[model samples]
Target: MATRPASDTQVLAGRPFPLGAHPEAGGVRFAVTSAVADAVEVCLIADDGSERRIELTERTFGVWHGLVPGVTPGQRYGYRVHGPYDPSRGLRCNPAKLLVDPYAYRVTGRLTNLHAAQGFVGDPARGPASTVDSLGSVPLSVVMSPGGPDTGAKPEVPFEESVIYEVHVKGFTEQHPFIPEALRGTYLGLAHPVSIEHLARLGVTTVELMPVHAFADEPSLIRAGRHNYWGYSPLGYFAPHPRYASEPGREVEEFRTMVAALHAANIEVIVDVVFNHTCEGGPDGPTLSLRGLDAPAYYLHTKRGHMADITGCGNTLDAGSPTVVRLVTDSLRYWTQELGVDGFRFDLASTLGRPRGGMFDRDSTMLTAITTDPVLSGCKLIAEPWDATGEGYRVGDFGAQWAEWNGRYRDTVRDFWRGVTGVRDLAFRLSGSSDLYDHNLRRPWQSVNFVTAHDGFTLRDLVSYNDKHNEDNGEDNRDGTNDNRSWNHGVEGETEDAAVLALRTRQARNLLATLLLSTGTPMLTAGDEMWRTQGGNNNAYCLDDETSWLDWTPSAASEPMLAFTRRLVRIRAESPALRQPEFFEGRTTVTGKPDLVWFRPDGEEFDEADWFDEDRRSLCLWIDGSNSQARNREGALVTDHSWLLVLHAGDEPLDVVLPSREYGETYKPTLDTSTADGTPAHPGVLEPKGRITVEARSLLLLRAPRDIVEGPQTP
Candidate 1:
């Protein structure tokens, strides 16, 4: 191969200690890792679109290094690694293809699905090296100045008190009327005063933004004129997605500004990171950054050189490799330390804990490394805890330090509120799913419980659609999950019948109540509190338009629902017994009462037969806050007034007899989900063993005074 002269710009052998292009005092040093490549050329693209090829003269421990004297920050560059182009051996190195830097701080342009971008010269069907230069086809990695130190402090809310709100940065503010048109759907919009005030009023402790890493639209989606709206298909892990920024080259700063703003509002920021796979699909996919550099080292491959697709995204990252582990850990540290992010929620997290050709391991190298690392261990680390590979549904199998998205909690809560499952499963879920997470010395907060997320139906759709409406995804309605435990409440989709609409509203309240009142770290999807809908689209991952954006316009149910949600959050915050950190021991404590007691509608403790009774849907839970095992910050035992929570999932209102005088002498109603403002018209006191009416598909909380008093039962 012929090389261009280095006469125009002086090049020197640079140090290979730090990867990617780093701008120093006089020039920029470029370093990239390509273990199997025989030659590597760093192409510097000038403002006029002219290219200067500088071959890296020094190779240190598989890293090619070169320094360009005149090149500085904002210089657009890419790599062309030369080696054998043999895909069967998992080595597809094509010098003609302009490759992205794995550690690119910012990517300048978008990638088009053109034939020239392919590694092969001719049709990819024949599998031959591409002699055509791909300099103009692929995006260039821009050399960026290192970000300054984060002087802002992170809002490290304790897990027991945290209420997470998962939102897509773009979708959350895309249609907000209060935000300026130029700033809408950008990081600045998310950090706007209106956004922060709404979140502060709603009482969420953390805002878990879905994947913001620099990502690419899949070639197939582009071919079909669709887009990957979720931003899960990552291209560079270190860079923030440029599309979400207000201006060019300001993504990192804008992301930091958003984090600072949220922190100022006492809300933590948890970014949803997708390190399990890349936009570069299967073995026949495009030759992007990692694939062109060293596919075998970065991705898991079968014996025949095929990609091991555990993430269902074509290729699963081989976290077992030290190189990949270093890359992931470094990326996380950068986000937490430099960008001021408080935590991370790993997407497809099971893939990170699974070994090659093995099941998901609780003690995987990646899991141990993350939990033991000093910086990451101090920060919150949450896992989705499941993938699409073999036995990947390890919900509670993650390390003790890590919290998991409790899938069992989600399913059981949905089933119970849908009025299909029995009270037994509901009881288990309400108590933070001890059956799934209790064995590993995990606390209740370790289970991040939620009814819906970005991947599934929104809370409104959960009560409006019985089936997923994903035809707009351009996949012929074949995409998205089928096991949506949803009920349409008398009619499918929107309804005009007053009774039907009322029932839907009631059911939505019931679901939200269960999620908040349950003993776990509850996660609320962004617009669930205001009854946002996706028009029955359960999987809006591909719908970037109105179907996915949160409509700020108030609907008929918006005010009441928002008020109810705010009240629920306030109640959860005020009541320590509802959000206990420890598991219920089911035994008497120092206060001479069990921390938790279950009662049937007849005011009797649940028997074994009652647990197995499928028809039993309403039950009463007496939580003895005075007997709580949780301790306060000063190491003293915390104490609060006892409380009673009545849950009724049946179709008709039921009269529930309060537990006998032994539990408490007097009870006062605190919250009722059936009421528009979550407060009853007439405040009343009830004697022990008194009967209180609970509406259909509603939840009620009663405060039981610690001091015993003989009081008359008020109807």
Candidate 2:
């Protein structure tokens, strides 16, 4: 039980419509949702560390409200919910724990003492409520002025044409040479000219920032002297993380500036959001905001009153409830409308779809709200498409208006480049994955394709390492996934062998080219284009030091790869054949050829029986864009150049015969992965039936000419 404050502060009954602490003309109206609290007090903390408590006298529909006079902007405050301490019933509320407002737009501090915030005295699940005052140790919510960002014109790039680049805010800017020393590793640093210039040059239309929502490091990590550098354990969804802001007390403004800079560069901003779970862990975890307010209503509980740990993060929010739906949608609208973010990439999104009984539903309340919200009408929504539980992998299961991270696309492409498969599934992956995403009228762009992401071996590492080396993470080399479909070309880790090094570069190019040229929207991991590696550490979630920070220095491997990547992006942008919104129809075109055809190296088209040839390692994807069945926004047919992409993953070089004149009269070399910098190995044009040798473990991209052509291109 909490004693009332000593000082006399006038408190009036405030209306409870919009939740959270909002400052108006008279004062700040504080409203908190606690379905099971006996009484609630808005504890105002002074700058000098003293606290004044004002009890909210009005209770309407499980919400407690009060208008505390004289409370202005920058006033730090918390909540003390007085209620039952019955863990068996999932109502573990204790006034001793200072609770943050679930709708707080800005929080000012970190939880220094973890144990002091726990509600129980002995065993956390069965013991009595502790009386330790968590006033000075816990984080406090600050009242903010209702001022939105001065965002200029929004780029609003169409979904099908988007090329996403997933980046970490700190790692991307921490070592940037041109960023100021003071601003490095901050949001303003990312907004700087050099950062924007790099992104613009890379041709990425969207930057999916990893978790900008305020998060807390795990207590286990704190005890081990490590940090959760990924920012997945969210503490406040509405706030821009203060750790990334250069100017203290101005995180919202700094984040807005970063968004504005990206918009100015014709890029969209998409934040990775974790709304499934929070920093408040399980039944034994600390008494954070949601747990202290009403654990049963805020968290999913088992029949035995234990918190459902489906997220593998302890507590899973009961998204089926109307309260949780309102919470998530409100947070999304705030980020979209106030701070000026263009999109969101939902982390562990499968849990949100599973609103009840641990069963996933496509039409859950939370999903429906986001899909229907007018505020989020045209915003891009990308889901990670899985959760911690084994049953949460719902790829291609998302309904209308939502895109999913295509895991199958990544696996198939990696396996194909590593010579681990025939071109059966590889063909499916390369041509929009129609089998997976063509249901319910989902287009090819609905499958966000990638060969590598934030939590796996990088593109360079995928070709250079066969096993994970996570010993630096202090997990005794027992962290990260083991099923890496990667081939190290008979050499593991770094080596001095010239042949092996050349092979690794080519393999990397093969993977990157496949990702960029695929028919779905590609999402490239940051720094992968410049030969970035984590020393084979697939999981760098806890390592915040230089091991995780992106090295911005140019080197022998970095410069060539960057140039190659830039050229590839340009090729993809210029070539409409690669950006097909519709899957191949196999229909005859105006040129008396099929819209899509798979040809063998012998200049013969692949028959139906050729798909089951398990030993075959080469295939050609021919796209006839001139008679393409795809349409623009106006539903008019688009016509572009026809293309032929050749992949030969065999150990020996093989001579490839160009297709006959039905597709095109001659072939113009566009890019060859065998070259060190994606240069054309064949500098001159080759006529029909001509033979060109594709070296071991490489790919070649060629375009058909309307007439005579000028040889291959140089980046």
Candidate 3:
């Protein structure tokens, strides 16, 4: 390799103490672990563009290390190492290519044009498929300043106590009335007092911001002049996407400010982290970060040197490698320790558990490390426990420390409200899908209940569209999921009929009631309370237009949805019976009756056959408030303020029975979704079973006698 001026100023001071680049007592120490490199060179470039080279004199345990005394922060540097060019052995080190600091906190330059973006495709000039060495065309690495102290403290709320509101940073407050026009789509907007106040009002304990890390537009979208609105394609893990951060501070600093502000408001900040793969993509993709750093080391690959395409993004990360695992762990720690993020909701977390035989390892090193790491121990770790890979769906398999996004809950609730008979599927969902997650002593909160999330249709769209309409997404409407399990409510798309609109509105209420009122840690997709929509696009991941933004000026149909959501949340907060941490034990310890009573419209206890009957829709669940798993602030066991939840499916009203509480408490009407304020219009004494009319596609909450207790009723 020729010694260019870019490689000629600083001498390599080999120090093998810290693995990756780190700030030592005096200056930064850069180290990279490579098992086969014959020699490692550190090229330091000065501010004036002068460069010096130093060959590392030492190699310890396959790790090349160097500590430059005067190499301060912001110093431009790159590494050149001599190793075999055997592709079969997975060694592709080319001394001519300047490699990036695997642990760089910040980068200063652009891709030395697009060729540098090729990363290590052999030769980009020959295309990504060529086998020739493409070292000269890739970009060089630069040293970055170290992150300062952590900006905020963790809110430290328990998983059961958390009310996560997932939002797209750009879409969330962009159309809000109070946010400034300039700051509407940026991080500052999320941390703005107006945004915080709204969360406070909604009783949100955490804000799960979707993909704030730097990301790139998918090539297909870029070709169509569209962009990935969901921001799942991560380009930089350490830096917040500059576009989301508006002014003076760097991406990390801007993110810290947002977290600090949220913490100040007593709300925690959770980031949706995409670590399954990088924006570099598949064989025909960009090679900006990991691919350029060390393709085989940073990514999972077949024996043929081809990257494994499991994440559906072109490649899957090699979590089995120690270096790769360290990279992921370090990135997580950096976000939690330096950026003050309260937690992470891992995107496609199953990829992180990939073991030796391509099967997911429940006890993978990365999973164990995270669950045991002190810094991350207190942080809320959520997992979207599946991926496109065949063996990657481990939904209920994650251990006690991890909370999973219960896709089953979402599907079951949607199906039940859509009147897809045999609600027995819903029985498990309403109780946290214990069949999937009950092996451990995990509570119901372990199932993070959600009806609709960012990846799919909004609450409004779910009941308004039977199919996705993503024509504007520039993919010929072929990009999104075909099976949305949604209903168009007597019409396929938008409708003018008042009755149809009313049904759609009521159906949205049903979904919300099922989610918020069910036992679990509920997560509301932001703007669902106001019935946000993506036109009819179920997958708006690539649409940056009005299709993706949350328009605060809601439609007429949205008002009722919003009111219903507020009422549902308030009721959940008011009733300890609804938010019980543990699963119902069936028999009540106090009354000796079932802790939960399921009834049909005829006031009969649900039979084994009724549960399996797919055509049976309407059902009532009577909750014994005295059996609540919570206590007041004084720590006394909560007493029965009994509540009856009546649910009806289909398009006609039905008379449902409210079973009498074993304590002889009477039923009083409290909240009715069929009404405006969500308050019931009438109250009546409890018979052996009291009957109430339930509107089609509606959920009603009926309270029991509050204070007056009844003496034992004679049979």
Candidate 4:
């Protein structure tokens, strides 16, 4: 419903301030920063596909500016700048191609393939019917309307106080029966009260939406009618994918509304951003915005113009270059300053850390700018930590300001639960991977722990598949990792065997327990609590159908998992001990006992043999709960309290000796995971026995009387 500006406009010398686009007295002032361009033309395309090119006369600070008097919000436009075609010095400007406004708040055009628009070396016959090199000159304008500019809303939830739920926007609610058919798989569907209420009930503070930006369906997948369901191949950074919005050109407003709605419910939004590379592949790939505009500058290249393939995508973005950094920084600022998003989860974050030598530099200018930038200071910044490049698999290497997806936590927890158990691995992760994160004085929360995410198998599928069933992904089964380390519980995929189902559900609970109980910040994949599965398709980055959606109606197992998750979150929120910002010291300041004491079922400290023995599956953990930074959520300090956690890595039952609590307190049986009904096995106190039997592949938590101890004392 946006209107176009008048045909003829004066070339008024616009102010060069406010770099990208902003509201002016008459309409919207358009500006783009490019030091090399001889001239920049803003092309306004009408509904009838007619174009009016307006030259921006005012230029300053490597920026071209012009005020279009009548161009209102939602107007479709693009730019074409005249510049040198020399590729050797990293300049390849093709004025024939219509370029996307790097700052455009909303996009209105439909993506169509054109053969000439691709690199000349590729098979020209593989493109769409219209073989013209130019993608119709249309300027996608950025403007301010009734709402004025964005409010730069920030939820400002700290890592310790945050619980992330990673989900796909479309797959999350696509098959949700409560959501209307038309709205399903759209932003509106995700924003529905049912969706928000469910997340709220689960007590997750943030929703890490997987790639809501405009993305392309890989050509091979398109031929097979399957697509990139995760939307990692970004087509536009500033604009939300049009399909997620209710209608074309409404994506901005829709996304803003979704943020607002979630904010009202006290949940923040974190986008899974893929700036490591673009949809435009290698030398023979499609010529999208950056590639068509200036190939070498925007993308990393070899001496002979071949694309650098660090990202495992056909090409890697030249984050080392200023223009590429500017684009990334500008896009980040736009999402925070203009679109009002809470934060971003960088996909393959190593790409952003890439320096000239293809090595990671913590002091990289881009990382420095983003962490210190005023606009992004209050927003959450998380990284996936590793990429396909292999050089930059920096888990704890990122500076202290950022939180990293603890991939080690994921792998270890999976391996332990799948019967490859060990006590050392469990102890390290439970105390928040001190070996990985503590070297730089970083807190436990710096490690964002999770058992599964959108990129891998769901909690259900993890216990149900030994290998990836990604055949439907059109990449054969070879697309996903072969090192899943998952177990199928003696039955692959779905099963009618009630015993196997029971085992899988228990494993799911064990995984969830491990994730939440870990000292680091916990992140749960959305629908994991409800036992959602992608049919064992670990790499469901493609497949937007029911495979990714959250089935609202939970089965018996899903219901139990959901309730358990809610209870676990409540327990975590109520107890300050579980959410420490600092690393746990082995010895307590108030008491002489180790703050975290490890024990074998034989009530003895772990030996070197125990640490290395792969068979060392059964172990007990004693946390000096009195060392909790503060009281519970009710502000009541349960003084001198202690808890012993027993973890049996396999399906064998073993006796766990409860370590004596400080100050003569007695042990109270709080929860046991072996029950098939998902409820506590014993409501009353167990006989004050030194040893308790714990089932295999189960977790047991025992609470000590709070009043017995006045200060820490050696057991």
In order, what lDDT does every prediction score?
A: 0.85, 0.87, 0.74, 0.74
Top-scoring candidate (lDDT) = 2
lDDT of 1: 0.85
Q: State residue 592's C-alpha deviation in candidate 4, in Å.
A: 3.4
Q: Between the candidate structures 2 and 4, which one is better when assessed by lDDT?
A: 2
> Candidate 1, 712: how far from true, in Å?
35
Winner by TM-score: 2
Clashing pairs in 1: 121-130
- CA displacement after TM-score superposition, residue 264 of candidate 1 (Å): 0.6
The superposed Cα distance between candidate 2 and the true structure at residue 36, in angstroms, equals: 0.9
Task: List ranges where model 2 is wrong by over 4 Å.
Answer: 1-7, 629-636, 707-715
Ten-residue region with minimum lDDT total, candidate 3: 124-133
Q: Write the per-residue lDDT of candidate 2 for residues 1-715, one digit (tens) a residue.
A: 2344635787788889799899975899999898899999888888788878888989999999988888899999899999998888888889999999999999888877877887888887688998988887778898998875786677888777889999999999898888998899999999999999999999999999999998887877877888889898998888888889897899988898888889989999999999889988877777768999988887999887888888888989998988888899999999988888899999989988998646888888888889999988679999888988778999989887889999999998888877778889999898998988988878888889998998989888898898999998888988789988887888888888998888899888888899899898999999998899888889999999887888999999899999999999999887766888877887677577778899999989999989999788999999987765445656565677889999998989989998888788788899999997788989688898899999888999998865212223111
Residue 672, candidate 2: Cα error in Å is: 0.6
Listed in order, each prediction's TM-score against the native is: 0.96, 0.97, 0.90, 0.91
Judge candidate 3 against the unseen true structure and give its global Cα lDDT, from 0 to 1. Answer: 0.74
Ranking by lDDT: 2, 1, 4, 3
TM-score, candidate 1, is: 0.96
| Candidates sorted by TM-score, best first | 2, 1, 4, 3
lDDT per residue for candidate 1 within 47-66, as digits (tens), equals 77777788887999999998
The Cα RMSD in angstroms, rounded to one decimal, for candidate 4 relative to the true structure is: 3.8
